[model samples]
Target: MNQRPDEDFEEDELELYEHHRILVDKGQSPVRIDKFLTEKVANATRNKVQQAIDSGTILVNGQPTKANYKIKASDEIKVLMEKPPRDTEVISENIPLDIVYEDPHLLIVNKPPGMVVHPAHGNWTGTLVNGLVYHFQHLPEMKGNVGRPGLVHRIDKDTSGLLVVAKTEEAMTPLAAQFFHHTIDRTYLALVWGEPEQDSGTIVGHVGRSAKDRKVMDVFPDGSQGKHAVTHWKVVRRLRYVTLVQCNLETGRTHQIRAHMRFLGHPLFNDAMYGGDKIRKGTQFAKYKAFVQNCFDLMPRQALHAMSLGFIHPVTKEKIYFEAPLPEDFSSVLDKWDNYVKHE
Candidate 1:
């Protein structure tokens, strides 16, 4: 089955438009451009293709083409379309932010757990974007990007960590490019159930939304599904039943670390969505169970944090790095684990 056109595309964080490039097959017969695109582009209807052509967003060989234009073998096609607008308007909220680093071009913020990065279906207010709009007037919004104003990328609402925000378009572009090219250096710290067989290793798999549950991600080791993803991880500490690991991302995908860890038989501790809420290791003693429950209570959410980020300054053309200390809950849980292991 064909995937959505955007599914495999590498979109920049700040891009407001969808850009698609398709190369005609050599054995293809001449066909109407709109008809060809309608068949080639997943979920695209003829009417929508015609509308795109009418708006001159469809180009053949670098020039805008008509709907009725005949597509020849090896013809290069490009489609650019503005993203659809959201139904709800983004209202700026006076939510406080934890600024890590700031400059004229960009700023790094340590987002607390449970705060949405942008307004979405269930999260319509009190998001980081809403606060950003309130704190800074006229922050550069990507053209056609409705709700998000300055975000180049984002972390999950339940995941606490560092995120970089672009203050200007000049800053947004290069930063976005860095993410698209996998040049941004991001390291996450996660406490996961069970110790990995190896002290350090690289996990290579395709990560995509689960077929059974669209809400969460899954790893496709066969490469028959999903986008290519790579995660490098090394054990930082062994907590007997659980392990503290540092993960470095080579390709960013939704829940890449969580999904890959789950695939490795070591789901992140307390990650309910990936089945880490239950005890995956250790003894079945009532005391041990109670102790594990206390650890979960200490940090109810996934034991994951975006601890460090490094990249070339979009404006300065210089490399810079920033790190955020583990949040109180995460730290407290680690302490509990240490004490438990020591006594055992």
Candidate 2:
């Protein structure tokens, strides 16, 4: 995937027309264009009208047009939304941050499960953004400049582990460069549905969206849209119906570890999206089926966590390694599986 360039926008001169992006509850048709702009553009003023038109802030049918342009059906409309001005009141709150390491240039945070790395739709507030906003003051702008302020790299919401956040633009550039070049070493611990035939192996292929379904990803032939993904796995322990594996990532595609494990006929235990029928069986096939069912029922997300992280520090220019112990949920499942195997 092509990396998005950092966009710098000063908010003093321009205002975001949030109303233009909002859904009309009634879905009414062809209201006056001027009136539409006035509602969407906050704190509309007389002078702002001319400014909107002249500066090409407002558009009619995707083309720059005057303010008085009337509305019509099937006309694609857009607005040049401005970013919010920087505020310095940002400070660390009692928002429960799992800080592993912190310094002037960067911080390594052990992001807990269910906490998103950054804000998205329906998850704007109470995200890692909310935490970072409260944690640091005057954080530098990032690539996708909206709610995500300091984030350099991201892990999935359910995937708990270490993530690097940049405090200054200098650090952000190098950290992002490291990820783009695939120099960052990331290791994950995952519980999969089946045991691999081999003790250790590597899975390499081009990852792209499945042609049959947009929601699914597959290892496709060359020239696909998705990038190449490589994962090396070693069996840590084997259960009757599942396997605990440590995975090292060579390329970080979306769901690379989980998808590759599934592709290798060993989907993560609680991964409903790719679990196949193996997940629905719960613990029924296990010696301690009840224990397995309890584990799966309580854990709503994927059973994957970033276990280790090692990379050259962007600011210090020295090697840095971080590790996170498996959370209780994962440990508990392993304990039960171990006991069951011992009895068998």
Candidate 3:
């Protein structure tokens, strides 16, 4: 079914913004960034470049710089703006989008749970990409199977959080570079089955598809196989049988947090893909079991959300950051736990 153009969308559970970046190549002579941008960027003028610099939207080698600053050869330049990029041929659905920020170059969105980032297999419709294809016109047509047409990165089908979309290649290139270099900052909030003995910790291991089950990933601590992954975590609050923790990713891998948490013996609450659907902690009493079952019924999926993101803007060269709050389902479940703990 098609969505109406005037249809309203749910309020974003979080905040987010867009980015575009660039890098000066070697063998280029020293030139003021304002004047230099005119020669390099399309439709950019000295006045616009100066305005971007003054607004602290441009960065030199990850640090904000002045418009008159001399950009040396090989220096990385980034730009953050609320602009949209060029267009593509994605199938436009009338899906409503929780647009956080947008310009001619890029767009930021707050994605809710139960929605896939891209289309594939049996889950082909009602994806975030379908919504974008509907909301934004003029996406550039490219050859081959363009999975995730304009996405910079992806969150899980059950994970709620922030994401950036590139409308043009100028925006995608630098953001992609930042991700490859492990420069983008991403943080997640997770509710796990047990509290950690330590207040803060780090998990370093390789993550790959499990031999027993190709659908889910497993963590290899011996470094013998899988892709390298690292997650740093700190306790937010302890709720008797469960703990809320914050996680920061050093290297993004499939199911890194869920797998690492399981390896640590604290799998995410109700994470059916792992072994968290059961009551891993708490009492074995019938009443306690009932309470946990209630919680499970309240929240059927893994309790995780992408809460924060930070990166260098591709065109403006300034540092840009985004944050999102918990959605209704997640927040309501937490409230139930909090009330239970206080009553007990």
User: TM-scores for all candidates?
Assistant: 0.77, 0.71, 0.73
Candidate 2 on 1-344: residue-level lDDT in tens? 35653211100011244235433434457676667767766787646755766666666755677766666666666655443334323334447788898888998888888886655443456677678878687777655554567876677777778888888988887887777777888888988886678999999876655544433566753645566778999999888677889999887776777678877878788876666324533344554566666777666677888888788888789999999898777788788778867785
Alpha-carbon runs more than 4 Å astray in model 1: 1-88
lDDT of 3 by residue, 288-311 (tens): 899988988888889999988898
Q: What do the candidate models score in CA lDDT, each in turn?
A: 0.84, 0.69, 0.78
In model 2, state the lDDT of residue 243: 86
In candidate 3, stretches whose alpha carbon ends up further than 4 angstroms from where it belongs are 1-90, 140-145
The model with the greatest TM-score is: 1
Give lDDT: candidate 2, residue 299: 67
* Predicted candidate 1 versus true structure: per-residue lDDT over 1-344, tens digit per residue: 22222331221121224368899999999999989989889899999999988766787997778889999999999887545335647798899999999999999999998888887655678899999988887777654455688877788887999999899989977877787778899999999999888999999999876745545778999898888999999999999999999999898887888899999999999999999999999998999999999988889999999999999999889999999999999999999999999998
Best by lDDT: 1
lDDT preference between candidates 2 and 3, better one: 3
Error of 3 at 325 (Å): 0.6
What are the root-mean-square deviations of the candidates from the true structure over C-alphas?
Answer: 10.9, 9.1, 18.2
Question: How many backbone overlaps does candidate 3 show?
Answer: 38
Question: Per-prediction count of colliding residue pairs?
Answer: 0, 2, 38
Lowest-scoring 10 consecutive residues by lDDT in candidate 3? 5-14
